[model samples]
Target: MELNSDQIKEILPHRYPFLLVDRITACEPGKYADGRKCVSVNEMQFCGHFPQQAVMPGVLVLEALAQTGAVALLTEEENKGKLVFFGGVKQARFRKQIVPGDVIELHTEIIARKGPVGFGKATATVDGKIAVSAELSFAIAEPESRN
Candidate 1:
Protein backbone atom coordinates (compact mmCIF):
# COMPACT_ATOMS: atom_id res chain seq x y z
CA MET A 1 0.00 0.00 0.00
CA GLU A 2 1.17 3.54 -0.67
CA LEU A 3 1.70 5.69 2.41
CA ASN A 4 1.83 9.48 2.46
CA SER A 5 3.96 11.57 4.84
CA ASP A 6 1.13 11.90 7.40
CA GLN A 7 0.48 8.18 7.37
CA ILE A 8 4.18 7.55 7.67
CA LYS A 9 4.34 9.90 10.64
CA GLU A 10 1.65 7.81 12.35
CA ILE A 11 3.88 4.76 11.97
CA LEU A 12 7.27 6.35 12.71
CA PRO A 13 8.44 8.50 15.59
CA HIS A 14 10.90 10.66 13.67
CA ARG A 15 10.13 14.26 12.72
CA TYR A 16 11.49 16.80 10.27
CA PRO A 17 15.27 17.20 9.85
CA PHE A 18 15.49 13.59 11.10
CA LEU A 19 12.67 11.81 9.30
CA LEU A 20 14.56 10.37 6.39
CA VAL A 21 11.78 8.70 4.45
CA ASP A 22 9.37 10.83 2.43
CA ARG A 23 6.89 8.11 1.50
CA ILE A 24 6.38 4.38 1.12
CA THR A 25 5.74 3.01 -2.33
CA ALA A 26 4.92 -0.49 -1.16
CA CYS A 27 4.51 -2.47 2.05
CA GLU A 28 3.63 -5.99 3.16
CA PRO A 29 3.03 -6.49 6.81
CA GLY A 30 5.67 -8.62 8.55
CA LYS A 31 7.39 -9.19 5.24
CA TYR A 32 8.91 -6.27 3.35
CA ALA A 33 8.70 -2.61 2.39
CA ASP A 34 9.92 -0.20 -0.29
CA GLY A 35 10.34 3.51 0.36
CA ARG A 36 12.20 6.59 -0.81
CA LYS A 37 14.08 9.55 0.63
CA CYS A 38 14.69 12.59 -1.50
CA VAL A 39 17.98 14.10 -0.53
CA SER A 40 17.89 17.88 -0.68
CA VAL A 41 20.40 20.69 -0.16
CA ASN A 42 18.19 22.11 2.58
CA GLU A 43 18.86 19.15 4.85
CA MET A 44 20.65 20.08 8.10
CA GLN A 45 23.32 17.47 7.56
CA PHE A 46 24.31 19.08 4.28
CA CYS A 47 25.88 21.99 6.10
CA GLY A 48 28.46 19.90 8.00
CA HIS A 49 28.88 16.88 5.75
CA PHE A 50 30.95 19.04 3.34
CA PRO A 51 30.39 22.65 2.45
CA GLN A 52 31.70 22.43 -1.11
CA GLN A 53 30.54 18.94 -2.04
CA ALA A 54 27.85 17.68 0.30
CA VAL A 55 27.37 13.96 0.30
CA MET A 56 24.73 12.09 2.30
CA PRO A 57 26.54 10.09 4.95
CA GLY A 58 26.56 6.31 4.70
CA VAL A 59 25.17 5.94 8.23
CA LEU A 60 22.18 8.15 7.42
CA VAL A 61 21.41 5.99 4.41
CA LEU A 62 21.44 2.95 6.65
CA GLU A 63 19.18 4.77 9.12
CA ALA A 64 16.78 5.49 6.29
CA LEU A 65 16.67 1.78 5.51
CA ALA A 66 16.07 1.02 9.16
CA GLN A 67 13.28 3.57 9.30
CA THR A 68 11.62 1.86 6.36
CA GLY A 69 11.80 -1.44 8.22
CA ALA A 70 10.32 0.21 11.30
CA VAL A 71 7.42 1.50 9.26
CA ALA A 72 6.82 -1.99 7.95
CA LEU A 73 6.72 -3.38 11.44
CA LEU A 74 4.81 -0.58 13.15
CA THR A 75 2.07 -0.11 10.58
CA GLU A 76 0.49 -3.34 11.80
CA GLU A 77 -2.36 -2.75 14.24
CA GLU A 78 -0.72 -5.07 16.76
CA ASN A 79 2.45 -2.99 16.82
CA LYS A 80 1.04 0.51 16.77
CA GLY A 81 2.15 3.03 19.45
CA LYS A 82 5.34 1.08 20.02
CA LEU A 83 8.80 2.43 19.44
CA VAL A 84 11.19 0.50 17.25
CA PHE A 85 14.76 0.86 18.39
CA PHE A 86 17.90 -0.27 16.64
CA GLY A 87 19.35 -3.39 18.18
CA GLY A 88 22.26 -4.09 15.87
CA VAL A 89 23.60 -3.94 12.34
CA LYS A 90 25.76 -6.41 10.42
CA GLN A 91 27.63 -6.54 7.10
CA ALA A 92 26.84 -2.89 6.33
CA ARG A 93 28.57 -1.63 3.19
CA PHE A 94 28.53 1.62 1.23
CA ARG A 95 29.14 1.22 -2.48
CA LYS A 96 28.75 4.85 -3.55
CA GLN A 97 28.19 8.39 -2.35
CA ILE A 98 24.65 9.79 -2.16
CA VAL A 99 24.46 13.51 -2.72
CA PRO A 100 21.76 16.17 -2.79
CA GLY A 101 19.09 15.78 -5.49
CA ASP A 102 19.45 11.98 -5.45
CA VAL A 103 16.34 9.95 -4.83
CA ILE A 104 17.28 6.99 -2.64
CA GLU A 105 15.11 3.91 -2.86
CA LEU A 106 15.17 1.64 0.18
CA HIS A 107 14.12 -1.99 -0.03
CA THR A 108 13.87 -4.07 3.14
CA GLU A 109 12.86 -7.67 3.74
CA ILE A 110 12.29 -9.43 7.01
CA ILE A 111 14.87 -12.12 7.78
CA ALA A 112 13.79 -13.29 11.23
CA ARG A 113 11.42 -12.57 14.08
CA LYS A 114 11.51 -13.37 17.81
CA GLY A 115 8.92 -11.89 20.12
CA PRO A 116 9.50 -8.17 20.17
CA VAL A 117 12.64 -8.27 18.08
CA GLY A 118 13.07 -8.66 14.35
CA PHE A 119 15.84 -8.85 11.78
CA GLY A 120 15.91 -7.53 8.26
CA LYS A 121 18.09 -7.20 5.19
CA ALA A 122 17.95 -3.80 3.51
CA THR A 123 19.39 -2.13 0.45
CA ALA A 124 19.49 1.50 -0.70
CA THR A 125 19.68 2.26 -4.39
CA VAL A 126 20.07 5.25 -6.66
CA ASP A 127 19.26 5.00 -10.36
CA GLY A 128 18.96 1.22 -9.98
CA LYS A 129 22.50 0.95 -8.60
CA ILE A 130 23.03 -0.02 -4.98
CA ALA A 131 24.45 2.66 -2.72
CA VAL A 132 24.24 0.74 0.58
CA SER A 133 23.27 -2.66 1.99
CA ALA A 134 23.06 -4.13 5.48
CA GLU A 135 21.57 -6.69 7.83
CA LEU A 136 19.79 -5.00 10.73
CA SER A 137 18.02 -5.97 13.96
CA PHE A 138 15.55 -4.05 16.12
CA ALA A 139 13.34 -4.36 19.17
CA ILE A 140 9.95 -2.88 19.94
CA ALA A 141 9.45 -0.77 23.05
CA GLU A 142 6.11 0.16 24.53
CA PRO A 143 6.19 3.48 26.27
CA GLU A 144 5.55 3.34 30.02
CA SER A 145 2.37 5.32 29.69
CA ARG A 146 0.99 2.79 27.23
CA ASN A 147 1.67 -0.15 29.46
Candidate 2:
Protein backbone atom coordinates (compact mmCIF):
# COMPACT_ATOMS: atom_id res chain seq x y z
CA MET A 1 0.00 0.00 0.00
CA GLU A 2 1.12 3.58 -0.67
CA LEU A 3 1.53 6.13 2.12
CA ASN A 4 1.47 9.91 2.24
CA SER A 5 3.53 12.11 4.58
CA ASP A 6 0.96 11.93 7.38
CA GLN A 7 0.92 8.15 7.23
CA ILE A 8 4.71 8.16 7.16
CA LYS A 9 4.71 10.27 10.33
CA GLU A 10 2.78 7.48 12.08
CA ILE A 11 5.79 5.20 11.62
CA LEU A 12 8.78 7.56 11.77
CA PRO A 13 9.61 10.14 14.41
CA HIS A 14 11.41 12.54 12.09
CA ARG A 15 9.62 15.75 11.17
CA TYR A 16 10.08 19.05 9.30
CA PRO A 17 13.62 19.63 8.07
CA PHE A 18 14.56 16.13 9.19
CA LEU A 19 11.66 14.25 7.66
CA LEU A 20 13.17 13.33 4.36
CA VAL A 21 10.76 10.71 3.05
CA ASP A 22 7.76 12.46 1.47
CA ARG A 23 5.78 9.53 0.10
CA ILE A 24 6.07 5.76 0.04
CA THR A 25 5.19 4.16 -3.27
CA ALA A 26 5.97 0.61 -2.24
CA CYS A 27 6.46 -1.16 1.08
CA GLU A 28 6.75 -4.73 2.29
CA PRO A 29 6.98 -5.32 6.00
CA GLY A 30 10.46 -6.51 6.98
CA LYS A 31 11.52 -6.71 3.35
CA TYR A 32 11.82 -3.45 1.43
CA ALA A 33 10.40 -0.01 0.67
CA ASP A 34 10.53 2.69 -1.96
CA GLY A 35 9.91 6.37 -1.27
CA ARG A 36 10.54 9.80 -2.72
CA LYS A 37 11.58 13.25 -1.56
CA CYS A 38 10.98 16.37 -3.59
CA VAL A 39 13.87 18.75 -3.10
CA SER A 40 12.83 22.38 -2.88
CA VAL A 41 14.96 25.51 -3.21
CA ASN A 42 13.21 26.94 -0.17
CA GLU A 43 14.75 24.29 2.09
CA MET A 44 16.72 25.79 4.99
CA GLN A 45 19.91 23.94 4.10
CA PHE A 46 20.06 25.73 0.77
CA CYS A 47 20.49 29.04 2.62
CA GLY A 48 24.09 28.27 3.60
CA HIS A 49 25.09 25.12 1.77
CA PHE A 50 26.94 27.19 -0.77
CA PRO A 51 24.33 29.94 -1.26
CA GLN A 52 24.77 30.00 -5.02
CA GLN A 53 25.16 26.22 -5.35
CA ALA A 54 22.67 24.58 -3.04
CA VAL A 55 23.58 20.96 -3.34
CA MET A 56 21.73 18.54 -1.13
CA PRO A 57 24.06 17.03 1.44
CA GLY A 58 25.18 13.44 0.85
CA VAL A 59 24.50 12.49 4.46
CA LEU A 60 20.89 13.63 4.15
CA VAL A 61 20.50 11.58 1.02
CA LEU A 62 21.71 8.54 2.87
CA GLU A 63 19.39 9.38 5.74
CA ALA A 64 16.53 9.35 3.28
CA LEU A 65 17.64 5.93 2.17
CA ALA A 66 17.85 4.77 5.77
CA GLN A 67 14.42 6.21 6.42
CA THR A 68 13.12 4.15 3.53
CA GLY A 69 14.54 1.04 5.14
CA ALA A 70 13.10 2.10 8.48
CA VAL A 71 9.67 2.18 6.92
CA ALA A 72 10.02 -1.45 5.90
CA LEU A 73 11.31 -2.50 9.28
CA LEU A 74 8.85 -0.51 11.35
CA THR A 75 5.85 -1.68 9.36
CA GLU A 76 6.19 -5.07 11.00
CA GLU A 77 3.74 -5.47 13.87
CA GLU A 78 6.44 -6.26 16.43
CA ASN A 79 8.37 -3.07 15.63
CA LYS A 80 5.56 -0.58 16.09
CA GLY A 81 6.16 2.48 18.27
CA LYS A 82 9.90 1.96 18.07
CA LEU A 83 12.82 4.04 16.88
CA VAL A 84 15.41 2.90 14.41
CA PHE A 85 18.88 4.31 15.14
CA PHE A 86 21.76 4.51 12.74
CA GLY A 87 24.17 1.77 13.72
CA GLY A 88 26.71 2.13 10.92
CA VAL A 89 27.30 2.80 7.23
CA LYS A 90 29.49 0.70 4.96
CA GLN A 91 30.97 1.51 1.56
CA ALA A 92 28.88 4.61 1.01
CA ARG A 93 29.22 6.38 -2.34
CA PHE A 94 27.69 9.56 -3.75
CA ARG A 95 27.66 9.82 -7.53
CA LYS A 96 25.42 12.81 -8.19
CA GLN A 97 24.66 16.19 -6.70
CA ILE A 98 20.96 16.47 -5.79
CA VAL A 99 19.45 19.94 -6.00
CA PRO A 100 16.17 21.81 -5.95
CA GLY A 101 13.43 20.47 -8.26
CA ASP A 102 15.01 17.02 -8.08
CA VAL A 103 12.94 14.10 -7.00
CA ILE A 104 15.02 11.68 -4.98
CA GLU A 105 13.76 8.12 -5.20
CA LEU A 106 14.91 5.99 -2.30
CA HIS A 107 14.97 2.20 -2.41
CA THR A 108 16.15 -0.20 0.26
CA GLU A 109 16.40 -3.96 0.70
CA ILE A 110 16.76 -5.95 3.87
CA ILE A 111 20.10 -7.69 3.62
CA ALA A 112 20.31 -9.15 7.10
CA ARG A 113 18.13 -9.38 10.15
CA LYS A 114 18.93 -10.49 13.67
CA GLY A 115 16.82 -9.53 16.64
CA PRO A 116 16.77 -5.75 16.98
CA VAL A 117 19.70 -5.20 14.64
CA GLY A 118 19.51 -5.36 10.88
CA PHE A 119 21.37 -4.38 7.75
CA GLY A 120 20.01 -2.80 4.60
CA LYS A 121 21.35 -2.07 1.15
CA ALA A 122 20.02 1.35 0.18
CA THR A 123 20.17 3.43 -2.97
CA ALA A 124 18.97 6.91 -3.84
CA THR A 125 18.31 7.77 -7.45
CA VAL A 126 17.41 10.92 -9.34
CA ASP A 127 16.05 10.76 -12.86
CA GLY A 128 16.87 7.03 -12.92
CA LYS A 129 20.58 7.46 -12.10
CA ILE A 130 21.96 6.49 -8.76
CA ALA A 131 22.84 9.51 -6.62
CA VAL A 132 24.03 7.54 -3.59
CA SER A 133 24.38 3.98 -2.39
CA ALA A 134 25.26 2.41 0.95
CA GLU A 135 24.96 -0.51 3.28
CA LEU A 136 23.27 0.76 6.40
CA SER A 137 23.22 -0.92 9.81
CA PHE A 138 20.37 -0.18 12.18
CA ALA A 139 19.28 -0.87 15.74
CA ILE A 140 15.62 -0.78 16.67
CA ALA A 141 14.50 0.18 20.15
CA GLU A 142 11.38 1.06 22.06
CA PRO A 143 10.69 4.70 22.80
CA GLU A 144 11.18 5.86 26.37
CA SER A 145 7.99 5.53 28.37
CA ARG A 146 6.43 8.90 29.17
CA ASN A 147 5.32 7.70 32.60
Best-fitting candidate, scored by lDDT: 2
**Candidate 1, which segments miss by more than 4 Å at Cα?**
none
The CA lDDT of each predicted structure is 0.92, 0.94
lDDT of 2: 0.94
lDDT of 2 by residue, 1-147 (tens): 689999999999999989999999999999999999999999988998869889998988989999999999999999998999988899999999999999999999998998899999999999999999999999999898898
Q: How many steric clashes between backbone atoms does each model show?
A: 0, 0
lDDT of 2 at 101: 98
Off by over 4 Å in 2: none
- Give per-residue CA lDDT, model 1, range 46-122, as digits (tens): 89999899999998998999999998888778998989998889999999899999999999888899999999999
RMSD of 1: 1.5
Clashing pairs in 1: none
